[model samples]
Target: MPAVPGRLRAVCLAAAVAAVLTGCSSSDDGSGTGSGTGSGEPSVAETPRMTLTAGTELPLDAYERSEDDVYALAKAQNVLTEQCMKRYGLAYDAPDPSPPAHIRPNARIFGLVDAGEAARYGYGSVARTGPAPTKPKSAVLGETAKSVLFGPKTKKSGKALAEMPMSQTAAEKKKSGLVVNGSPVPVGGCLRESYLKLYAPTSSSVDIMYVFNLKGEAESRALSDSRVKKATKAWSACMKKAGYVTAAPASAARDLGFSGEAATGPGAVTAAKADVACKAEVNYAGIRFAVQSAYEKRSADRNAETLGLLREQAQDRLRLASQLTS
Candidate 1:
């Protein structure tokens, strides 16, 4: 069958539902609390952990090490001990009168160690689990937003797909039955969607993924139940209150997963799978809104780079969708 188009009007209606329904963040410790296993006792659910092999770089080691050892290491590395202390909420022991000079703390360094520890021992950082701020839908809507949303469907050929402009491909995809709010959107108009793949080395790994969607000049709507909408709205509202601007033209966000050997080799593979079939459409919003929402909601729990990459992809896709639609 010829695909349905995603109409702005329909999208607006859907946005209304979504605005009231999607997005949220978790705590800084990465733990989800709940009842124990049939014990009727309150339980502090532990967050999933990650492991790191030897020769890996770790930044937070300074914070995790003995204060004296860290002090010595910092001095040797030409890092200002006091500044490093402050960054990780430790007491400064150096007596330089004024704060030490040129002690640049690297988030990457800290993150490497933090991630390694989490992987090896299954414990995440408290500060890393805090909720991120919220963002607005307008932040993502750009000059080409309309075109990408209504653009053409994208083919699967590596070269053809790569050669096809994002906006044009989005337009084509809209015509191929991609629906938002139960209406047909014209190819080359205003929205976009795509799929991603993720992998988990062990069944114990959290393997969680998120799918975000944003809309403009319209409220967010939810296709699912109220719980999902409520969670998303809470997350979105938090981001808006935090001062982020949406910068993408169009986009879609989703979490991907894999298991066993597939998770161990390579990272993860991208695949075309139905959203409904996977039961993965927990939350959806515009690109910018979704980015902010995810950051504000899960920023502390996940790798900052991972979140940043996801946001970038969403924004890029949005731009492509707009181009195709226009």
Candidate 2:
């Protein structure tokens, strides 16, 4: 039976995001050396011995060529293996034909091979014997709500929502305020139509992207309701009871016939925006809530980050919807 090393097992279970970010290859076999023995008949009293070197390059077929060739390959492979083990703090072992079940193929290992070759030939970070593996593209998503909301859906196409021109003048026309609580918040001009375009980055995995879009729509609707005045008032009372300050309604001049309140906390760099948008035709109303909070985490770090970023983006969508409905 092939021995399954513990270190290799750990790499297979690491988070995909961490794997991508750390630039570590999961497919690397912890055992770096190969061995072979001479086939010719030997004296009964003689013991066969082999020589090895660490940090050298060897071809994959070197073992099949000759005793000298096998020795050279074994030495080189052992050297490369030793260097990697030292770098990662893993145990060294001879190569095994059957590796662990979880071990996957990685192109990055080829790079290490090339580096070993280089080290052998006086070339820094170049391999002297076999071909090195290829480096995969880092999965980074684009900066559109739509892109992030839909991952692989957008990854293959490389399409994102159109960017709209930022306009302070347009915001002013609607009686919107700038620098809410000194946070320098930009009032989006096309808040209503823009909701249709916001996408999450593409590099994000599928599950995370779906949650972002789903939550974004939910929060957007909640903020745009005309009945949000009562909800905001209730929420404000709750906040005050919880030791937060109460927010005030918008002034008549700045009010676009929409009912809502804007409040700032004592130490808040920005104020929260809450409003109600009425849709009599559909008999539906929306209550918008907009606020920023420090990113929070849950049990899993990556999941927590995804949720935190999604929540922030959802709040932005709500803010935009408030402007449109107002």
Scanning candidate 1 in windows of ten residues, the lowest lDDT window is 1-10
User: What is each predicted model's overall lDDT from 0 to 1?
Assistant: 0.27, 0.26
Candidate 2 lDDT over 59-178, as tens digits, reads 111111233322333344344433333332333443322212221222122111122232232112223243333443433423332222221122465532223223323323332232
> Which is the leading candidate under lDDT?
1
Candidate 2, which segments miss by more than 4 Å at Cα?
Answer: 1-207, 235-244, 248-326
Candidate 2 — worst ten consecutive residues by lDDT sum? 289-298
Candidate 1: segments with Cα more than 4 A from true spot: 1-77, 81-257, 264-272, 275-326
Please give the TM-score that candidate 1 achieves against the real structure. 0.15
> lDDT score, residue 213, model 1?
19
lDDT of each residue in 1-326, candidate 1, tens digit only = 00011111101112222243222223211212222112111122121111222232121121122323323332332223233333323333332222222222322221222232323322122233323423322333332332234333455532212222234333344353433444443332222222110112123222123321121101122122233344344433433333322211011112223334442223322111221111123223232222222222222233345444444543443344344334
lDDT of 2: 0.26
